[model samples]
Target chain A: MIKAFIALVRRDLLLAFRHRAEWFNPLLFFGMIVTLFPLGVSPEASVLRVMAPGVIWIAVLLAGLFSLDSMFRSDFDDGALEQMVLSPYPLPLLVLAKVLAHWLVSGLPMLLMAPLLALLMTMPQDGIAMLEWTLLVGTPLLSLTGSIGVALTVGLRRGGVLLTLIVLPLYIPVLIFSTNAVSAAVAGLPMGGQLDFLLALLVLALTLAPFATAQALRISLS
Target chain B: MWNAIWVFFHKWASPRYFYRLSGAVIPWLWALTLLLLLGGLYLGLFVAPPDYQQGQSYRIIFVHVPSAWMSLFIYTFMAVLSGIYLIWNIKLADVMVRSSAMLGASFTFLALATGSLWGKPMWGAWWVWDARLTSELILLFLYLGYLALVNAIEDTRTAARAGGVLILVGVVNIPIIHYSVEWWNTLHQGATVTKLDKPSIHVSMLIPLLLMAGAFQLYYFSLVLMRARVELLEREWRSEWVREMMGRGSDG
Candidate 1:
């Protein structure tokens, strides 16, 4: 079982590496959104500083969304997913492995790019580490929760907009906590409470999302 | 007792039997709903004394509170039915979930709309980002998402099962959303009736409130049953029972 899980993760990562555009698209998209916020909202450093946490978190979310469609699409198109479902290993384990690979490709790049974006946005230096912490904790939650939406819509021809509608509501709590934690950090206030909530959400998503995603994949494939 | 409950579910599990049973139950439900709604409205709008505080505007609670309650109730109800459908493949459970989605959405909308109207006079704005209001808005979005997903899928069985998964996911998130929103900000009043302790409301206000709540529940049942019956016909058109019923008359 562990071998299958490792093999699937390694396979997905290799495929993601080969398709370099998949890795760069989300990063480029994230950068573009951060740039757009300054142009679209304001160039004032104080305003951007105040808005930075929310702006960055929202960017991560949208960028994560941009990449979520690929999680199962290629495998599903080529019939690899059907075989995974039929494999003797429990489906959720395989689904979790794929999610881990997806977060690595799509979610982790956003984390690395955050400091540059934060600098560009004039975000306070104190908050940068907290921002990274929030992303470290919260981005996987995004991938896990988002895979459920992607899996549900995998079989459909026009699931792009519908995917946003269904999944965004579920993302609200994560958005609330992570943004609060970052802002608290910027203010030099106690952020333990908010970070704790984000961690709790992460744990919840980690445990349950794989099963739900697995079930959704089965339903979509059926 | 468990045997009796199992027997009841087994009997109602059949589309034909459920259709016949719901046909018999819906009229009584409608009649009772009409009675409760009229009596509740009369007592609430006329007999209930004007509030010393907000006066006539506070009366919107008669509509707002019950609609909010029904919105949450119906969503949870649909989740339970969907859970049954997923586990046992109960056709009627799927039909009920399908029938209940729009009704739930409408109730969620009504709650938000009425809350907005009430907020205008009370809160001095049409909408406030209060915790209760935000969660209710999210609830509306969840309903819309469910509807969009179900409609997007071409196959009925696939749609039903997919919707089941979606609703179950939504149900799990609702409390988390509610708490996080509350933690972020809370301007809306706390629960007056639903708390475990005796309701904080005056007896005069409580009576009509209860009456309206009962009316909403009955109305939901009547409408969902009517919609479920139509859904059953659409789903089971290839079956003999539907053919026989079609030949009889337009009336169920």
Candidate 2:
């Protein structure tokens, strides 16, 4: 089972790299939205500083959203997902492996790019580390929960908008906590409680979401 | 006695039996809901004395609080029904979820609207990130997500099963969402509870709040039954009992 998990993750990563454009899409989208914020809202540092946490959190979420619609699309289209479902090893483990690969390619890039966005927003220097740490914990939870959404919608041809409506609500708690963590740092308050909440949520999602994604994948594909 | 109860439930599982059973039961539910709502609104609006703090405007609680309660109640209820459907693959449980989602979303929306309306007079803003209000708004999005999943699929059974999985996932997040929202709300503003709680209001106000909550529940039961019957007819349209019903012939 562990071998199968690695093979699935390796295959996903290789595929993600082979089509290098896909890797850059979420990154470029993240950069563009960060750029757009100043145009839409304001260019002043104090104004951006006040709005930095919310602005960066929302951009990361939208970039993740942009990438997730295609999470299961290629696998489902190529019939690889159906083969995975029929395999003898446990399906949930395989699903978890795929989610891990997705996070590495999609969420990690967003997390890496977020610092540049934070710089653009002129967030206080002290708050940057906390913001990065919050995203590190929060993004995988998005990937885990987002997989359940993708698995449910994988079979439909016109699933993009509907996918957003289904998945974005599930991201709210993560957004609220992660953004608050950064805001606390900005306000010079103790950030432990908010980070602890984010970690707790990540643990909950990590334990529960794979099984659900596996079940949803089976039901949708069947 | 246990055997008889078991046999009774076995019969109740049949769509034909349920259609008739709901028809027989809903009138009583409707009558009860109407009485409670009418009585509750009258007492809540006129007889209940003003709050020392907010005075007359607090009466919106009659509509606001009950709808907010129903919002959470219906989602948890949907999770229970979703569980039953997932385990037993029962057709009726799925039918219940199909009808319940829209009603739940509307209640969530009403809660937000009323909560905001109440906030403007009290909090000096059109909206505040109060824990209850924020969580209720997210609850609305969750309902919308479930509805979107159910409607997006072409097959009824597939939609029901997929939406069921989403409900289970949503249920796991709800408490965490509520807790996080509360924590976030407190981090920004000082510690304060929203008006949904009753410490400030007297028993005269409390009675109507409880009554309205019960009335909202009864109204949900009747509405869900009515919608369930429509979904049953749609799904089972080509089956034997439905054919007989459509032919104006007695099945028994």
**Top candidate, metric TM-score:** 1
C-alpha lDDT (0 to 100) for residue A19 of candidate 2: 92
Candidate 2 root-mean-square deviation in Å: 2.8
TM-score of every model versus the real structure: 0.98, 0.93
| Candidate 2 clashing pairs, residues 3+ apart or interchain | none
Clashing pairs in 1: none
Query: Considering only chain A, what is the TM-score of each predicted structure?
Result: 0.98, 0.98
> Residue by residue across B1-252, what tens digits does model 2's lDDT show?
999997887689779999999999999999999999999998998899998878899899889888988998999999999999999888899999989999999999999998888888888898876777788888988999898888889988898899999999899889877877786664223322235553554779888998999999999999999999998998999999989887886534
Model 1 chain A poorest 10 in a row by lDDT: A118-127
For model 2, the stretches where C-alpha displacement exceeds 4 angstroms are B1-6, B186-200, B249-252
Candidate 2 CAPRI category:
high
| Candidate 1 per-residue C-alpha lDDT over B1-252 given as tens digits, one digit per residue, 9 for 90 to 100 | 999999898987898898898889999999999999999999999999999999999999999999999999999999999999999998889999999999999999999999999999999999999999999999999999999999999999999999999999999999999999999999998888878978888889999999999999999999999999889888889999898888787765
Write the residue-wise lDDT of candidate 2 on A86-147 in tens digits: 99999989989999999999999888888888988898777898999998999999999899
- Candidate 2: lDDT of B89? 84
Query: What tens-digit string does per-residue lDDT give for candidate 1 at A43-146?
Result: 99999999999999999889888999899999999999999999999999999999999999998889999999999988778799999999999999999999
